[model samples]
Target chain A: MAPSDERHRARMARKQEVVAAKVARASRDKGLLLVLTGIGKGKSSSAFGMIARALGHGMKVGVVQFIKGAFSTGEEAFFRRFPEEVDYRVMGEGFTWVTQDRQRDRQAAEAAWETARAMLQNPELGLVVLDELNIVLKHGYLPLERVLADLSRRTAGQHVVVTGRGARPELIELADTVSEVANVKHAFAQGIRAQKGIEF
Target chain B: MAPSDERHRARMARKQEVVAAKVARASRDKGLLLVLTGIGKGKSSSAFGMIARALGHGMKVGVVQFIKGAFSTGEEAFFRRFPEEVDYRVMGEGFTWVTQDRQRDRQAAEAAWETARAMLQNPELGLVVLDELNIVLKHGYLPLERVLADLSRRTAGQHVVVTGRGARPELIELADTVSEVANVKHAFAQGIRAQKGIEF
Candidate 1:
């Protein structure tokens, strides 16, 4: 082999050792608390993907949509197809700005939380997705401390994914993994109405 | 009614009119090019979510996976269940860093691109997810100009979602919607192994 090729192989071998060591270090197995948040799209979509992944493994999942339920969504329709595997619920009336009724919104949020809390408690549910729960918390419709406490109370090996914009810092602190989907550009801004399958 | 309640209603009514005007202005109906990129998780997962959404709407979709085919994935397993709606293809042998074979990787990318091109030409496929195509472009495995040209050739009502880290600037410029999944924290970094449903 050429000198450059030989050098490259050696470098890769060294790097492989490092990665292997890191992989070995991560020996523990525990269900994770994941938070997908930011002022961009895909947070809830990613959670829905995880729902599919969980269902792929024959794992039971529960979905609680806390806000933005004014219209039906593609995910809701898709996941609901598997009633046995996916326990899907659309609990929000709409965004707080749209609802314009703090009492009604709070009641909706509390009802959604009750459902999420029940799912969290059930060890049989391998994954629980709280879609847009962060928005409910952000609007002060639900108590953050209580929500965090319930998340902590989930049984071992029960993964939870919380999604929405403006995730609380406390929730971030308690999460095992956190991702922020940052908006670079949006189609709606360009005079394109939200499509059925793609957006809703 | 209370004075505060009356004032709030008036404010909401005024803001609703403003939003209504903007909604009225958005009259265009065209297929969009969506790009999901950044050094974070969920780019491919979001693409899979879109696949599910499209399938729910009875829309045909094609998926071309690049740079990550060393092991089987949950998405491949799940989406394969719907053979009628999803044309799933895993073309990449592995990442370039792991494969360490540029010629082989280039061939794999070329093959994947060929599959993608076929999907793009068929307007019957409502959404074509070019999973990890960005990585191929970033690594110069495929020509960006050729890829962009093919994307532009897709029928007026056909949508495409390109997902991977390190998206080309030109691709972003061409895309109607763009999002960057920013990594805040990863569980693997804390010595936790990647779990099946959540990571795979």
Candidate 2:
């Protein structure tokens, strides 16, 4: 290509760069209700990231782990150390597969929902993460419509994140930002197994 | 509470739900980049959701995997079945910790960057996921400024995602959406081990 042609391309590229940056900046101020859905790992992990970020910004943060019950995560371990800043709950049930009781899962989900609903209503709550929540919704353990209704009604400026696999299309439609964590290549797939502090 | 107070509370609660739903809907058409950062599993998985959704909408998609060179993810396995619709690359060198060689890592990053840059330049690309890219920037193995500049210059309709822990502040500052996965309660800590097709 001619030098002049190359220069023209460079100039156009630079112009495009400026335009893209401006557009991204405009989109940042927009609040999003993200849905991290997919048949993969990391939905809760991604949700927890937002929880920590919200807390870091001095934003009120609340977390309700539907299937996890009251256990310690690397995040809760750190955040719960200063309990005043975080409202954390773990539903004490492992998962549907482990527990293998829909009725019991439903009870735990309902119990967790009470807390989640409270968090959603709190105007001071900047971020609310419903970790592993889709399982509850998917298993029909929780009423999807009510959960969506409550989530839709969260206080202004409050951001809610719902994470789990098999997220319903209706919920995805309702979400401001819907993300699916599709299983791609994973180390564990190679028989490496999950390493603590890495896959947790 | 007085009867009037109870009625007013119900009314206000209902209003909040509507408003939250409105905000979420309005956010969809607006293209945005969300980063999933942390030591926990599932960042790439979350990104794949966006890729699949984008494709479902008949939107063009591109992916650049930083640590995973030439290997295929489960999603990739599924997605590659429709190769004509998706552009994907897996950096074969794996993670920085695994490669353990700065020069090789840089070369791998550069190779991944080359593909990513091309994808960024493609106006037709609707969603671009740079998986496990945080490590590259965190370790200074890749130039942040160039990545940022490229991202800024990418197509306005394009939504870019970056995944990995220890992302640079500049990258986070530039992100339209930022999520950090914190380790709260993980089953791995209990020696339950990561089950196949689930954890992977």
Candidate 3:
């Protein structure tokens, strides 16, 4: 096609996209499951977005923080404002090394899993954010089969997200979608420190 | 508490977390919007496990998923990956019924404020997952304030995840972590039936 023709096609395509967006917006479907794996960061950050997003819409939200425990971060503080808006929980007992207790970690995992299981069973729950659970299974902290079964049996409309490094092939296989983060580079390696709000 | 009591408590805590799987993973601190927004099914699933937990390990993660994107479906996907993870964007699209105009859904506010801008400005974007962005800001179709500015100013250390109903956000987001999927939800939802692997 001539350049003018190509330009016209592009313009038309743009218009069509605009219309499509409108249609999609008007035709929203049920929520989804997102699995974040690989060697990159931002998995939890993305999940938090969903948690906040769900609450913003006046939808009930529940968060299970597997590794961070119940410590208050900027996000937890923000989420706290809407105590009624979101049913959130910090599952982990701080950092693994800080705790320096294997048994404690296992207990934390089990406790968190219990909450996760309960939330999963609730039919009305719209979105469930399971942060850093891959490691829980990878380390055998939680029964993989049980987690898989629960996830498979979750409410039809509920959306679930699972994040962590070394995501098991079984989990990936079972997951509706899988993402592997391949690390290209990092700033900490260059002797840079983390900043607040941005890195907290 | 007394130091001796604290010591005893710490020891007990350590014993509890024992046997909990612990793996050392590396993450990056880039300052760009690493979006995973598309018309795919697993944006949040992928974001939660990897990004959030990474943040928990002293890494920073930011997330933003458009539409009534919040809610806890009872999955440990994102927050489990915290510390290394923080920052979030929930589109608050709330279901399609509220966001009647795909082209001008409520995220128009998000798009206008440029929540992505603040996230992009951070130099420690170990991961920036723009969960569900494609549907939210396709062609700047919605309010085009912040999303545009952030997309334009994003640096390299940040990662973004965007997931949800559509794919236009992908055009400008320029995802380093891009994966688009056509979901196959439960067959029963489609009326025929609900299978385990293909549908779940």
Q: What are the per-residue Cα lDDT tens digits for candidate 2 across B20-49?
A: 455454433434555777654546655764
Model 2 ranges off by over 4 Å: A1-30, A69-72, B1-200
Candidate 2 whole-model C-alpha lDDT, 0 to 1: 0.65
lDDT of 1 by residue, A61-124 (tens): 9999887655677787788889998898988987665776767877898898999999999989
> For residues B45-67, what per-residue lDDT tens digits would candidate 3 score against the true structure?
44553453344345676666554
TM-score of candidate 1 against the unseen true structure: 0.94
Docking model 1 quality class: medium
Alpha-carbon error at B61 in model 1, in Å? 1.2
For candidate 3, the lDDT comes to 0.57
Q: Which segments of model 1 are wrong by more than 4 Å? A: A1-15, B1-15
Model 2 agreement with the true structure over A105-153: per-residue lDDT tens digits: 6688899999999998898777787888887788787888898899888
Worst 10 residues of 1 chain A by lDDT: A4-13
What TM-score would you give candidate 2 relative to the actual structure? Answer: 0.51
Residue B28, candidate 3: C-alpha displacement in angstroms: 15
What's the CA error at residue B194 for candidate 2, in Å? Answer: 34
- How much lDDT does each candidate structure score? 0.85, 0.65, 0.57
- Sort every candidate by TM-score, greatest first: 1, 3, 2
A-chain TM-score per prediction?
A: 0.93, 0.86, 0.82
* DockQ sort, best first: 1, 3, 2
lDDT of 1: 0.85
CA shift of B100, model 1, Å: 1.1
